[model samples]
Target: MRVSPINAACCVLLVALLGAASGAQATSIYRTTDAQGNVVFTDNPERGGEEVELNPLTVVPSGQRAPAPQSRPEASASPSSPSQAVSSPFMPYSTFRIAAPRNEETLQTGEAGNLQVELGIEPALREDHRVRLLVDGAVSQSAMHSDVFMLGNLERGERVLQAELLDASGEVRHRSAPVTLYVQRASVNLPQNPNNPN
Candidate 1:
C-alpha cells in the first residue's frame, strides 16, 4: 500500500504524543495555611507554601504481563470435619472474687439504700468478657463491663450477691465466691403509749 505524506506525519506525531504522556511524572503538591486559618493545597507555591512529597505511582508496562494471583486452599465440605476456630489473645481468668462488701458483713444503707459491689479478676478482664450480678440465684444485672456495680434500694434483710463473668454469647465463664451481706435500715415508729407525744 502506498502511504500518503500527510498520513505518515500524523502517525509519527501521534506516536510522539503517546510516548510523552506515558513517560510524564506527577508534579509535587504544595500545602499552606492562609491568614484566615484555612488549609490550602495546590500545585503552585507562594510565601508560606511547603512542597509535599507523595507516594510514587506504580506503572505496569503494556508489553510485560502481570503475575497470576495465588489461590487459597479450599475448606473441607464434610460436616464431621472440624473447622479451625479463631483464637483469642486473652486467656480465661483463674481467680474471680468480690473485693468489696465482704461475706457475712453488714452495710449501712445509703440515702437511697444503695450498695456498691466491686469485683477482682485475675489477669484482668478481657474486652469480650462481661460481669453479671446474681441476686438470690437469679440474674439481677446483665452485661456489666466495669468492675463496680451499684444496687439501689435494697431491702433491710440478709441477701446473697454473686458475680459472674460471661462471654460475648452470654455464657457463664467464671463465678465469684458467693457473698452474703445484711442491709441495715433505720425504722420510724410512734410511741406505744397514747399520750407519748412530747
Candidate 2:
C-alpha cells in the first residue's frame, strides 16, 4: 500500500488532538471511612480504589450570559424583624462587608485562607456576633463572639463562602456577601535526581 505525505500528516494531527483531549480530563477523588474507623481511599483499580471525575461547565463560548433568576422561597414569606426572628431567618440581610484577603479568586486548593467581617451598624447595635465558614453551602467552621475565620485545607475547585452574624436575640444581624473561592489544582510533582539518598 502506498501512503501519501499529506495523508500521513492528517493522521498525525488527528492522533495529537485525541491525545490532548484525553489528557484534559479533570481527576477527582472520593473519600469514605473504613470498618476500623480509619479513613482509607485510593484511585487505582488494581488496589480496589475508585476514581472520581469532574467536568467543566460552560455557558457562552466567549461572551457573558444573562444572570440566572433566584428563586427565593423563604424571603417572600413575610417581613420579619431582625430582632424578632428566632434565628437568622436564612434570608438576606444587610450588605456584606468583607475586609480580609481582598482577592478570594486567587485561592488555591489545599491552601490556607482567611476572612474578616466588619459590621456596618450605624449606631453599633448591641448584639452578640457569630461567624461561620461555609464551603459550597456547607458549614465547615463556626464560632460565636468572633469576627474573623480562617480556612485551611480548602479543596481544589470553585466554592461559595459566606458569613452569617446573629444578633443577641438570635436574629439575623448581618450576612456577608457570598465570596467566590476559585481554587486551582496543584501541579503534579515529578521525581528529579532519582536515587540520591545518601
Best by TM-score: 1
Summarize candidate 1's per-residue lDDT along 1-198 as a digit string, tens digits: 344577557545544444445444565566566665545555555555777565454567889877878899899685421122111112466567888889998867343358888887778888888888887788887677888898877777888998877778876666677899887755545344232344
lDDT of 2 by residue, 1-198 (tens): 344577557545544444344444533433334455434333334545345343453434448776788976675667677544433433343334445545366664234333343433323333455555566778776556555556666665676776666655655455556677676545445234232232
Model 1: lDDT of residue 164: 74
Global lDDT scores for all candidate models: 0.67, 0.51
**What TM-score does each of the candidates earn?**
0.48, 0.39
Clashing residue pairs for model 2: none
Q: Give candidate 2's whole-model lDDT.
A: 0.51
Q: Model 2: how far is 14 from its true place, Å?
A: 99
Looking at candidate 1, what is the lDDT of residue 77? Answer: 82
Model 2 poorest 10 in a row by lDDT: 189-198
